[model samples]
Target: VFRSEPPDDLSSEKDRVRVIVRVRPMNTREVDKGDRPILTCDTETSILVDGPQHSRRFTFDAVFDTNSAQ
Candidate 1:
């Protein structure tokens, strides 16, 4: 999770918070082991985790996938 300060003009909204999720790319080891990516970010604010048994969806204020820039 990441937090940011509102502008001085919006100091009264200090109580607000923002959530962010970043999905990292596969490493060399995982690639060598033939591991497949199970997480997908179809939208800018959501992530989908696909598992063998089931799938789950998560929402956030911002979502970054493997291809996102630093």
Candidate 2:
């Protein structure tokens, strides 16, 4: 979430904004190991706002599965 205030020269009525959200695809990678195999995955969520003090937010999550957590 984000908030913005209009400039001193601008009035509140003239200030408006829009927001856009996107969930990007996850990335997976493989690793080589002599004892066991390792894998990793990550995903990201982005929030973009355009107009009147543009702002953005990004969040990311990561997980590792070793055949134990399915």
Give the CA lDDT, 0 to 100, for residue 49 in model 2: 34
TM-score of model 2 vs. true structure: 0.21
**lDDT, candidates in the order shown:** 0.79, 0.33
TM-score of 1: 0.74
Kindly list the per-residue Cα lDDT of model 1 for residues 1-70, writing each as its tens digit: 4223224553344666677889999999999999999999968988888989998777777899998877
Model 2 ranges off by over 4 Å: 1-14, 30-70
The whole-model C-alpha lDDT of candidate 2 against the native structure comes to 0.33
Q: Compute each candidate's TM-score over C-alphas.
A: 0.74, 0.21
Deviation from native of the Cα of residue 12 in model 2, angstroms: 7.6
lDDT of 2 by residue, 2-69 (tens): 33332456445546433323333333532232232221222222333333465443322222223333
